[model samples]
Target: MKKLLIIGFLSLFFAPLAQAQLGIKGGLNVAELTGREGESSSYKAFYHVGVFYQANIIGPLSIQPEVQYSLQGGNLKSAYTNYDSQLHYLTVPILAKLTVGPVFIEAGPQFGVLLNANQSGNLQVGFTEDGQPAYGNESRPATSNFKRGDFSVVGGVGLKLASNFSLGGRLVAGLNDINDAKNLTGINDPRLQNRVFQVYAAFQFGDGRR
Candidate 1:
């Protein structure tokens, strides 16, 4: 089913070079991992970049399919230490877009395949609270516990600045757990999921009206 969807999108992507608009986009990601054992998840900053194709189905309505490479993760701050984990994925989103003048809104399902993941931060091995050795602090690379693929839903709004340029923002919420318990990282939550807020600018080729 996933393969068929990708293939269909690709056909839409290449149907007519003159009729459809192609765009390149890059963005900032504010990511957080939810469903923790006890610790509160903090936001981590990352980035994403990709290409997309837009095809109009009717007035003020369109379909867009995008392929993006994204960096996502979360931060953990505790009484003894702090940790930062980064996960990288290749993602695709197929969106139904609606426009009103210069403003447009979009909603869609996104799919991702994990590329890589890692963590690095300061950790307390032992602590000294009362003039005695209680906790030790050291910097090291933490273990990674990540799944191979991720499923998510995305929604956003954008405003067209001109015929060729636009500014946009979106939220992506993971529907599946991106953590693997088999590769247990004692520092990370077992049921890790992705939550990201993205801000982006898009540059489109050819003159396409919104």
Candidate 2:
């Protein structure tokens, strides 16, 4: 937790260095599992509030590094089971950005440090206290002991409008495992490593820098 605070502090301190740009972004995200099979297909809304720094290396090429607090996960349901798990990650991505006229594209890898994770749901089995068909077991929220992942891919596209404000979308695909539990069901795959997609609008400061 201390390291997360340090990263967050550095993100703010790097704003005024050189031609660094600061912006606010908010968007919807679609999250799901990848790599292995048998995992359920699900989508969830993920949003992040953060800042970014852009340093131009060439005419139309720049490197933008960002730090964000993101929420990502999915809802799963089986024949007799229903549950939902969400992951809150402090993600950092270093992207290579390209621009042409008003359109721009970026792609890079991201590292996600898990902040908090929880599972909540109610199991439906037989009947309720009233004898009618109802939820079997009451929902009990459980915290997760999740470890941080190494690397992931971060890429997206956007358009610059009037030089100061821009609109874009990006996706973060996790490559490292997030689960550290001992499996008894023979499922060795990690559950915290999921996919996140974001669409946001940015307002760049320091005019004539776009």
Candidate 2 C-alpha error for residue 191, in Å: 6.1
Off by more than 4 A, model 2? 1-17, 35-39, 123-145, 183-192
Model 2 vs. true fold: TM:
0.76
TM-score of each: 0.80, 0.76
Q: Which parts of model 1 are misplaced by more than 4 Å?
A: 1-18, 123-144, 182-189
Quality of model 1 by C-alpha lDDT:
0.83
What CA RMSD would you report for each candidate?
6.9, 9.1
Top candidate, metric TM-score: 1
Cα deviation at 128, candidate 1, in Å, is 16
Question: What's the true lDDT of residue 98 in model 2?
Answer: 95
